[model samples]
Target: MKLQAIFVGLVIVALSLFFLSPKVNSLPVGANVTSNTSSNWSAAIPSRTDAGGTITTMVLDAQSQDDGWKGYVGNISGKFTLDDASGYSIYDWSFTVTEGEVYISRAASPSWSTAICANTTIISNEQNYFGMTAAEYDIINKTFNETIHQSFRVGVVDIVNSSCSSAFTYVNDSKYPYINESTPFQEVLLQTGTDLIYAALLETDNEGFHTGYTYDFQAIVPDNRTNGVTTTYYFWAELGT
Candidate 1:
């Protein structure tokens, strides 16, 4: 029995290793591609793998019966470095950042090509002062800096970090990309939905500006207030010089 079992295992391994074609006809059963961004997976699992040969969408964990009215506030920074096996910074490897992107999202990797977040301050899609449940408005009006959001649906992106001496934004806004311009203090009405959301990470640097920056950017995310379930927003970044 042992000999037979061993032979079967070898055959299975051999088939998995060498018998399959270089390209798979379809993703193996139960293949869980966790990325739900609008763009299809590149190089690995193209749309042809699906039966329809069309782009497949992996929708997020949509939730209802809960208030979409919670807030996150934070600063984001990045380090572009090459590390040795021991993780020591290899300074000679050369690293510089011309710009950086920060994403406040419920998805681990939001799409760079798609502006999944639906809020923007450019032209008011939502009015901050209204379009809220009385409960939500009352709660925010009572606690958060209502002055930041003002009575506007969307505010200008006027983030500043010129030097260690200038005022910088403490948080980021959940807004659309593409048409977004880099500024700080872009405020919009509290968006309502359980769909996965993300925001453009505005750059705040000490490039001739006031500065006390630990990180390169700041952002915020809205979440569901379901009891016993703490919302988890993923923060992702990319840097280039």
Candidate 2:
């Protein structure tokens, strides 16, 4: 009788602990939150594997419920980086929108425009704000306070270490093999369904303006036709140095 009583007590204790665990305390599966000034929005990175590289995505949305699927209405932001074992140097990066009306936002100042298809002027005093050493960025700030982002939708951004030679090499050299060096990085930011949602930003190396080798944005519109279940927004990234 005592043995059976102890076994019953153990089961009750285990059940109590399981229900009180931190995992159970997480945001309910189908809840959605948003933050414009900060990256407090609900986001996730879906895993993927490929020959060229492994790609990951950081997704954000405002879903009515957490059905482990898509947000009813929100945005997707993805960043790419080199796998430590890949042994690669980032020569260029690109952002492609396969579906929905997606826009990109790279500027810190809210006043800066967030148009994806337009060649907008960037007004900021911070040189290489996205990526660079404090001292090096200071030097650039002292030398040329502001620069222009040439009109580009897909292509390479110039490296800071080289005398604009790396951009030419990546664009012209068959070994490196890249396209549209004219497409500026600043122009890659996309616009979303619920205004321009900017989060999941990756700073570049000291020698580069951005850390991410590539960035892709996919905005999935809410599906009203379904039985209140929205499809997940797809955000993908291909990592390289």
Candidate 3:
């Protein structure tokens, strides 16, 4: 009985040591050091659209600071017209891109459209001119630079539009009426330890018929990869009036 008790005690001590031993280290040395190295990044060729009455295309342009990755960092331009005679307004835009690359995208207009109108009392349900007053201006302006930018992942090469409600803003709020957009700075950081292509598309619905309201759609790519290598990709935009 004493021998059995001694054996049990030994087993307990062995198990305790096994459980309490220090863990082995496995990460590479200086993995947290920062370096600024220039790379050979290029912008994908841009496609033009005239469906919105005015078509504008801006190249994705970027510069590497201390060897950082660079490409496009602003809005791609597009336009459409609206007339009050018709109840429904339709605008379509699309961009073609390489499959398997990650990207962050968003849509934004100038502060003029986003600003509140001077007359807050002008309100109506069937013809809410107050809500659409800026849209009216957008039609008259014919075209403006509204940018949607996204970051360092890959998505399949395909067409994206505002009709794809998942990819766009669907609300009537004054802040973002036309498209849903995000930047790569937010998306890529969230997706650490993964490699893939990403792309984004944006669009808006026509509330009324106006002769010259236009929306300009653009996509931008900003690589956030730590390793210094120039990445190349392409995207195309098509406007559906």
Candidate 4:
């Protein structure tokens, strides 16, 4: 009876430690702008447009609210902006990313712009965004000592003019590969961290006026677990240029 009692006590103590341990601080998922301003234009690029507009930068804080055992586990919070440089209020954006976790961004054309143009081409596409996974991201941090994956997303917004349409496309060596036609909202999973990611305003096949638009980018990080220890999940984004 005494031996059985000691075993039960040990089991209770082990369970307590498992539930009371501090989680590791893993690298956050999603895009986070450490600092942002108009003066920092090296990383910002102009978009092809007919309206002659300029690009503006802003930051947003993104967070996720899904609870699961493993899929899509992390908070997406960061700063990104609107790059409107094409004369027509259209802009292109890009980012260099590292591998750590899967990330996603959401874009939308607000209700206020419905009257501005009904036939606008405001769709979320992926062909404009680029990504590549790097070997450096495989390094295990002593703090967490777990593997991470890096990913990014490009969102499209406010393309409502029937004559004008926008899309996300992937370009390879200056040649267009894939194009996305869905507007205002789209999502992509970036598994590779070796290449640069870009977002651009697509031209209409029929040749028409380019309408105004807006978009947001986000990065996603996955939960980290090892040896029965799990890290607190977080999403972050870093801006360049």
Candidate 5:
């Protein structure tokens, strides 16, 4: 897989949390639920959605992310509401990410493109970095020059239930955990010993240094360039319960 040398700061947010490894598990017979780097093929849900729960603060756990700046740290935080006969708030929701993905698609309801994933698969710098090892990050950083602003336009991976599948729209899938939606998404690489996180970005202590960004969940996603701008990438997660 070819990668561009462009740099992007860390970014994370709570859109539709949950991801990484693809696996299906048995549940105790109930409705589906939601969850998030939780990327290590592990389905353990450390947190869940509460009544009108909102993760306003975001703090990057330095211990988990000891690699330092490679991607932009962002908070895609939001609440889930049911569209039943009596619009109500969800409760006691469990979180799970079966064979899935979190897409960084176009802003508006746009056509899915393979190139968008490549554009967003960036070489995150001090401003941002994620889901990669420090050594791997250093190699990429050393290889690509900061001034070399270019585009890879490689395309998307062939994941089972990802945006790559033209017919696999989350809004139409009954198994999708969080409040279903119609959005584009974003994928990845080698390195088994490495801490390749595609799940949720664990938050750390505010300790005063990190303010406003102290969110419940966070992750370093691709700064897509399909449209020649990073602002166009939209965060969408697919969950299973």
Candidate 6:
């Protein structure tokens, strides 16, 4: 695989809350609903070509208020225009997301490191695999002349009834347990031949498989000294794996 580098930065609002007082009438099952938030974020990915456009995202967590039909949708979607971008190229993109949540008494930082990985194979097999190690992150930071937070990891948890049938049946296929920064930062490696990004970033499923059980993605990074200060630039995107 050929690796070409282009630096693109994104600002995302993480851990923001929307105050929605429960209504007398609940949202209908399977009905698309949006949160009452005014926050908007923009991110960009450099393509094989030099020209670029805008990538916008609205972050929210939505679900039906029914007990029997409980579901999760990490309501994150992006719009982009990579000029004549070929599907077979690797993109070096960097994104920022606020690292803490606001509360009544005090703000709490993320308990784990979080990332969003693009399951490219779901759209095209020519694009395969996404990988990033601490070493690579170091290089990207130095190359871009930037300082990014190195903390916890956002892992793809097991979904009980993933819309992907095969994935639903074998929910525990990946042996990786959700770990925090006190433990070493393990690398993220997903290959087209074995895994797919179901719905949320940091999630993976058996190659050539998918499910309907969509969800929001997050990791537990805590407010500890050894872990460094929490900040934006807490997210990453990998094209293939």
Counting only residues 3 or more apart in sequence or on different chains, how many pairs clash (N, Cα, C under 3 Å) in candidate 4? Answer: 59
lDDT of 5: 0.29
Candidate 1 Cα errors over 4 Å, as ranges: 1-98, 109-112, 116-135, 138-182, 185-195, 205-215, 226-228
Residue 40 alpha-carbon offset, candidate 4, angstroms: 8.9
For all candidates, the clash counts are 18, 16, 59, 59, 44, 23
Q: Which predicted model would earn the best TM-score? A: 1
Q: Write the per-residue lDDT of candidate 4 for residues 1-241, one digit (tens) a residue.
A: 9988887865534343235445432222254435432211133344545455767564755543322112221222322233223424233444332222222223222122121211111111221121112232321111112112112222212222222222221122121333333332222222112221212222222112112321233212223323354434333333322
TM-score of every model? Answer: 0.33, 0.18, 0.20, 0.18, 0.23, 0.18
Note the Cα lDDT for every prediction shown: 0.35, 0.26, 0.28, 0.26, 0.29, 0.25
The lDDT leader among the candidates is 1
Q: Could you tell which candidate, 5 or 6, scores higher by TM-score?
A: 5
How many clashing residue pairs, candidate 3? 59
Instruction: Write one digit per residue (lDDT tens) for candidate 3, span 108-158.
Output: 111211111112121111013212334443221111123233322111212
**Model 1 whole-model lDDT (C-alpha atoms):** 0.35
lDDT of 2 by residue, 38-112 (tens): 122455655546556656565755434422212212233333332223536344344432322122233222222
Candidate 5: stretches off by over 4 Å: 1-82, 85-87, 90-92, 96-100, 110-158, 161-232
Q: For candidate 2, what is the total of clashing residue pairs?
A: 16
Q: What is the lDDT of residue 136 in candidate 3?
A: 43
State the lDDT at 159 in candidate 6: 24
Q: What is the lDDT of residue 230 in candidate 2?
A: 34
**TM-score-best of 3 and 6:** 3
